[model samples]
Each structure stands twice: as structure tokens, then as C-alpha cells.
Target: MVAFDRPHGMTPPQAQWELPFFNQHHHTLALGLADWAGAQRVDESDDRRACREWVHKLGEAGWLRYCVPAAHGGALDKLDSRALVILRETLAFHSPLADFAFAMQGLGSGSITLGGSDAQREQRLRAVANGAQIAAFALSEPEAGSDVAGMKTSARQADGGWVLDGSKTWISNGGLADFYVVFAKTTPDAGARGISAFVVPADAPGLDTSEHIDVMAPHPLATLKFTNCRVGADALVGTVDGGFKLAMQTLDIFRASVAAAALGMARRAFAEAVAHARQRKMFGQHLADFQLTQARLGEMSALIDAAAMLTYRAAWMRDESPTQGAGTPAYTAAAAAAKLTATENAQRVIDMAVQMFGGRGVRVGEVVEHLYRDIRSLRIYEGASEVQLLILGKAALKT
Candidate 1:
């Protein structure tokens, strides 16, 4: 693991928060978060340890409070999409791992927030808000990464309880999570309609999370295996055979925030590129003095701005539009567009930054090099770019 020194005085620009899409509270949150995120530094050589530390710090500072609702220790009355965007973007600008840790808290427990029983909410949401418990969402299986309905995991009734037998892979916070919101098929023949969700503790009797996966970036992933894992009836999250909708609902809420995260990374890369251009001497002058360098910087700036607008628009639509709830075609398309544009554009902008850095860009400890690895997964997860394109295409036909 290589640690790159954070450049001094490098912070994401706050001017965008002044747009009509954001309210004063959003601006206030951005300013406070920028200060807090800028001041914090953790040793990220060990990805798991760093993730745990970040969750703890974020919770203690009351930032994780935004992950849930005020009724359950959150700062807001509900999960505010704009606030989530601000928090993720700012944190990601400083550290992508921090953003990942923060995001999983909302995503892993999101179903509970949406449909958990009163008892379930009291038990889990509060603990999650406080960081006393870590959470993971187990949905993707080896064969079901993009096709949620193709999952083979099953849960059957047995002795007043449910017995789950299946596997989940590419699960973030897998080995480290205290509990998992595991989705499995309850009606083997019903496809997506057959799926159900359960809250399974990490220490559950037939559950295995010891298989850790190593990724190109600093994310803790694992493959989970369940061999007749049993949980009480109370463990079921939402209505029986409704896990698919609940899962999509949960993802919908965080989809725009994913775009915000990518925007943050792109801004960081752009900042690094500009700073480098101003300092690195070339031929007879600074790199910034060259018209070619200026042109590339202009292109990078335009890309970042375009991504930012899309990201903020998606978040704003979710937060402010009465009709923009999950499953609504319009909002869904907007979010898909944002995710697709931001992640793909971030990759391009980061690649441009790497090119500007020349040989130093590919060096192990270089910031752009780390960013190159960090930004690739964003395009694939939380709905791939191809999936987003299909969403937009289908939406266009509907219109």
C-alpha cells in the first residue's frame, strides 16, 4: 500500500454549492464538512483498518447522523439526498475510502430505514448512526451481479424461523460488518418476486465471511457463504418476497450520491493537474505556460463542470421533486444519467491528469496513479455505464 501526501491547501471548490439547486443548509454543511474532512488524516496502508477508523471518526463527529433519520439519531428528519451528496463529495475529495465507509452505512441499512418494523428500526438504525455496529448489504452473487433476479441464494421456512443457504460476493464491508442485510429467494420459481431480505449477524451460526477479496483500490470486499443459516422470524426486513423492490429502493436513494463521489474525485484530479502544471518546468517555461497544457486543463474543467451539474441536478430532483421517488421513470433516468456521466467523465479527466503528470503519473505513490485505480470501480459498481445507457434509452422511448 502506498500513501501519497495530500497536497497542502487543496480543497474542492465551494462555489458550486451556491447554485439554485442548493439551499443555505447545504452550503453550511459543505463548508463544515470541508473543514472537518481537510483536517482528518488516517494511515490507509491497511484498507480494512482505515475503513473502520473512518466510520468511527465520522460517527463521532455526527456526520453519520445524516445517514439515517432524526427519529433514529440522524441529523435530518429523513435521508436528505442533497446532504448525502455534499457529504460524499467533500469526503471523497479528501479521501475516497472515507466516502466508501460513509456510503455503506446508508446503503447497507437503507432497506431497514425504508421498511423495517419499529423494533427493527430502534435496534439497528440507532446503532448504525452511532457507529456501534457496522452494516453490509448482501445482494450481488457470482451469477447475479447485474441481473438481480438471477440470484440463487434461498431462504426457506423451518421451525418458526428462516434458513438461508446461498452466497454473496463482491460485498463491501463484508468481513468487517457487524450485520448484513442479506437478500435471498423465498419462492424459488418467482424470479425477482421470490426474493426476501433478512438481517443476519456476522456471528450467525452457518455464515462464513472469512473469504476476503483483494481489489485494485482500498476497498474491503469479501465473498459470503451461508450454509443453512438460521434467523428468527423477527429478522425479516420487509414484507416477504419483496426484497427486490426494497433493494432497488435502497439503491435509488444512494445512486445520485455515487455521482457526487465521482465528481469529487474528478475535482481532486483536476486540482492536482493544475497545481502540477503551474510548478513543473518544461522546455523553457512552466508546464502551465504552454497553450497545449492550457487546452487540456480547459477540457478537464469542462468535463468536471458537466459532471457536477448532472450530479447536483439528480440529487436536487430527488430531494425537491414530489414525483421523483424511487421507481419513477423520470428520476430513475436522471440518476442513471448522472451516475453514468460522472463516473465515465471522472475516468477521462483522471486519465488526462495522469497524462499531464508524464512519467510521475504512473509512479506507485503518485496521487494521480492512486486516483486512476480508485476511479475505475466507480464506473462499474452502483449500476454500470452500459446499464445507465440502457436506462436512458428506454426512458427516451417512453417519452
Candidate 2:
């Protein structure tokens, strides 16, 4: 494990896989994030602590600023897919939780970045960008993982404010978030259009978190339940009927970045596997000396490169899309494509790395072993591979 206590002073390392498409600024950012990530150690104990620490450090370094807008302390006017992809990919190579910490900052605060009022954006979004506060997005429910219309949470008009009731499940950064961007059914008969987004403060009346979720890769997660949680009308985010579009738009921007995170993991695995093949002796020769082993390593390298291309292509498409008349950027398609390919490829790449390590691969605490667990959740989160496939298929028919 990289020692977390080491002061954060190192620059990002030189990237071995820089592509011709990256500008000087991007290459510089990539190298800096990578070098900074390299010096840090993953904590084997208490992942939440590790995640929180990662958030503070990333925020302190001004990386979290990318999650918001320039007016709200971000580096860019809007979320930049290329920047996001590069950062996530680099951080995932070092620690999945670090990537998760960074991602949630964007995902949780995205609604505010995209649609919040100037006051809300200035106060809440700035806190998140500055690392002074943690934020959570509440959209998924027990029955609404991919179906936004199936949510049961509801909000209604009250005397002086809005009354919110019901629960949100699978909320990332749940218990730890200082505020939540919650989605609730404001008009059940309107189906998906009836949904609305609200900015719920952590200390709001009747807001509660039942338990911290212990997942395969531990981070700050929980189930949030609201019992008549009250917030003023100013808390309403965007248009009441426009919540679904807002949610999808937020996901569209972050989706490709998810793939970038997977790409980072694959790159790390490939690097480690190659190093092992060269060093580990087998029978009469080094593993890399064997033709079969060489073939496997070659295949892993090819897959990593291919996945990286697709990931970057998606990011580039989103960024370079024509702003004049571009309606709903093909980010949905690009993100889905990137997420599907990178995640599925990451699984294969990690499997190959683990195989190359032989017995040591499965041993507890091995780099490959930890990676094995870390890589599994990437395929399942944000949107599952199956979900991405559906999105891509729908997009293909449309195009």
C-alpha cells in the first residue's frame, strides 16, 4: 500500500501512453495527476477514511474544481469530458476509491453545476468544489435503478415550504455528503416528467440515513430516508417537470469518464502483469520468454490500447460536438459505448493479469488481488454493461 501519510508534494509522473490527440495542457494535467497518485498508498483498513482523505487531498490540490463551473470555483465553464476522462483514468490506475471520491463530487453536485440557481450554485457548489463540503445525488431507489419513472419518492407543497417524503437507495457518498441533490415525484400522474430535483441540506428536518452500505469495494454509501423533510421553494432545481432530462444529462457527461476510470485500472493491471511476466521464472525460463506467455501479454496490451482509444474518442466527441445547434450531444451514445467497452475490457485485462500472477494473484492483499475486487464494481456502477448496451443499441437505431 502506498503510504497515505506522505505529504502531497509529488508531481504526476510522465505518462507512457500519451496519444497524439492530447494537447499540451491535457498531457501536463495527466502527468501531474498520475505522479500525484503514484506516491499515495491504498489503505487496507477503513476504506471510508481513505476515501474521505482522498477527497480532501484532491480538493486541496484543486482537482475537484473541475466538477463545478468557473463561477463556482471550477477550472472550466462546464464539465469537460476530456479533462474528466483523463483525471478519472489516471486516478483509477492508482486507486479505485480515489476515482470514486472524485466521481461522486461531480455526480453529486452535477445538478447544481448544470441547473442550480445562482445563489444555490454559489453557496453549495462552491463548498463542494473547495472540499469544504461533500455532496450526494439521490435519484436511484429500490425499484428505480435504471427506470427514472419508477421512483416512489414524493414531494408536495406545504404551508411555507415543500414537504419531501420517501427514500433513495444506492446513494453514493450518502452518509458523508454535506448536502444531497434529491429527485422526487412531484406529480405521480406525469410519470417521468413529474419528477423534480431539490437541494436538500444534510441538517434538514426529517432527513435521515439508516445505514452505511458495505459493498465489494468500500466507499461512503448509504440508504437515505426522508420523513416530511422540509425545504423552501428556492430549493427546487431547474424546472419541476424537467428533472428527468436533468438527471440524464448529468449522467451523459459523466458516463464516458466512468469508462476512463475502467481504462486506468486496465492499464495498471497490464503494466503489473507485464512486469511479473518478465521477472517471474517458469520451469527453465522467465515467463515472458515463453511464446504462450508473450502472446497473452501482447493480447492484454492490445486490449488496453483499444479500450483507451474508444474511451478517448467518446470524450473527444462530447467535447468537440457543435455547440450552435447540437441537440442533446451524442454523449449518451458515446458514454454508453465507452462505458461498455472499457469496463468489459477491463474485466478481461484484469483476469489476464491475475492469471499471469498465478498463485500470488489470488493471495490476500496482492496488488492483482486488490485490483480484482476493484475492477468488478466498475462494470456494475454508473450504468451496468447491460444498461450501456441498451443505450448504445437505441442510439444506433436513432442514428
Candidate 3:
């Protein structure tokens, strides 16, 4: 039995969030969430509904409050790195879909939480925190995967509001989100500086979810089309031409959390593999007795520990950076490093677990199989490994 001191009555702990970087409060939160998630079951059928349900559960449990500010019903005045780490690790341990559900709420509404006016925060963030609404971050376009400046989504001046006309592809929670924080180009000639952000409600006229992209993981994802979708002047987030920086900064804060989620998945898979090795015997000896198997297990543990350190360090650097509001070059570099290392190492760790399972690993319904699928998108999303490498190289050259 696990020694996790869960509050009141809770289930077994799958994985704890305790680390040298986390504080006592973070440790308590991690233990509680891990216990809670361990008791929950993931329904593979209707993954969208499952994700929505998970969001509601997280909200009811008061975990969703970390997505917003205290003035707007959140637990903290701003998003805290440690809280994010704890939440992601716990949610991911239960179900990656659940983690995605909780994460998009923060990603989709983070801009407003960081730079929105009081009215926007009250209207959007409060409802989101209360689970009365779901949120989406619409930044990727059909043509602009990693290159934000190349996006063609346009926002033109209008009588009472701005008219958005374009399409965003591969948006997480696209078909499910109650609202989206969309980025559009307001000035054609100014390039990236021409972009602006807007809070587009799901019921906004002329907005349509054109298509749902079926992925291997089978969560809610879609392409959103805005054909002359008009939003009020007050819907503009932050300042015109400042959306790019805001989006980048928002991503910087959450990137390490993505790594943390990946790490949790790796940790679960590793534990399962280890258990299997110890329980399963081959050639009159347990699989754990094999020298090669032991070596693989040792390597997997080392990789997971290293990934955890890098991921936590990145989150800590963001929280402790000198420039509170503006993004710091140092923090940016550290975050990129963490994202790069954690994602790549998660891939390795998951692969090792899959290998350890041998033929059973390739089975369609196996836990290792599910993890294999869950981890693929982590590398591509947020920022790709190649992209992170380039970002780090550019930062180093500048220094």
C-alpha cells in the first residue's frame, strides 16, 4: 500500500508530485489530486464527453480555479507554476484526455487572465472557473503551424465591432469549447506586429466548426472557420499588435506543464512495465531477473528523473524570473530547454516501456499502447522538438 496521506477519504496514489522544486502546499495538492485521479476510471468510448466530464469534475473539485485569478474565482492572483505542475501531473496520471481538458481551459483563457480588462475577466474567466463554460486557444492556422506571422486569419475594422474572416486548424477542444481566444491579423502590411487577439464566444454569428480532425488519441479536435464573424470592440484582448507577444508569453508559462504531463504518462507506463517484469516469468526466471531487462528498467528510471528535473526547473525559472510582466530572455531559454529535453526523453521512456512489454506492448488494448499514442502529440504540440532546438540556438547566439 502507498503511504500517501490523502485528505479525509481518497483512493490510492498512482504517482506523487513531490519534488525538490515543489513547496509543501504543492506537495499536499499533488498527493490529494493523485489520489483522487487514481480512483477515477477513464471511458474510452465518447472521449469528448469524457473530457467534458473531466473538466466539470476538476472544476467541482476546485482545481479549475488555478486557471484564473483570485479576483475572478481562481485560487491565486495569477497562474502559479507549481500549481500548474501539480494539476497537470495528477490529471495526466488519470487520463490524458482529462489533462487536455483542464489544460485548454488555462491555455484558451490565459490571455484574458493575463491582459484582459476587468469586464472581460469577469465575463469569461469567472464563468470558465465555475465550469459554466469551456475555453479554446485558436492560434494555429492551415498555413501557419509554427510560424505565427504567416497566419492569414484577418480581422477588419467594422461599424460596431471587428469582422474576423479565416480558418484555424487543429484547435484543441474546438468542437467542445464554449468560447475561443482567437488570434487574427489586423494590419496586412505590418506582419507579426499586425496581429490582435479576441475573445470569440461559441455562439458568435458566422463562426462555424467546419470539421473535426480524427486523431489517434481520439479527443475533440477540429478546424474552426470564421466567415465575417464580428466581435465587439471590447473583445480585443491586450492591445492591437501585441497579441503575438502575449501568446508567446502565455505559452512560455504553460510549456513546462506540458512536459510535466508527459512525464506523468511516462512515470505511469514505467511503473506498469516494472510491475509486469517483476510478476511475469520467462525461461524459469522472472523477467526482472534478466540482466538486459534490469538495464532497460534502470535506464528508464534515470531518463524519467532527468526529465522531471528539467521540467520542474523550467517552471521554477518562470516563477522566479525578474521581469514579472514582460517575458525574460533567460526564462525563455530555460523553458525551451526543458520542453526540448522533457518531450524527447518522454518519447524515449515510453519506447522503453513498450519494448519491455515485448509482444504484449503492441496489443491494441494495452496500457503501454495507449501511452504510446498519448505521447506522440506531446512532441508535436506546444512546440515541436526541432522548433525548440532552433529557439534555443537563436537565444544562445543572441547572448
- The candidate maximizing lDDT is 1
CA-lDDT, candidates in order: 0.92, 0.82, 0.83
Q: Give one digit per residue, the lDDT tens place, for model 2 in 6-100.
A: 22332222453367546777877777776666666656478767778878888998999989888889988877888998888878776778888
Candidate 3 least-lDDT 10 residues: 1-10
Ranking by lDDT: 1, 3, 2
Model 1: per-residue lDDT, tens digit, 1-399?
322247777778999999999999999999898778767878999999999998999999989999999999999999999999999888877788999999999999999999898998999999999888899999999999989999999999999999999899999999999999999999999999999999999999899999999999869999999998999999999899999999999999999999999998998899999999999997989999999999999999999999889888888888888787556888999999999999999999999999999999999878888889999999999789999999999999988
Q: For candidate 3, give the lDDT.
A: 0.83
Q: Which is the better candidate, 2 or 3, if ranked by TM-score?
A: 3
| Model 1 worst lDDT run, 10 consecutive residues | 1-10
Supply the TM-score for candidate 1: 0.98
TM-score of each: 0.98, 0.94, 0.94
Model 2 C-alpha RMSD to native: 2.8
Global lDDT of model 1: 0.92
Candidate 3 residue-wise lDDT, 151-217, digit = tens: 9999988998899999999999998999999999999778889999999998899899858899987
Question: 280 in model 3: Cα distance from truth in Å?
Answer: 0.9
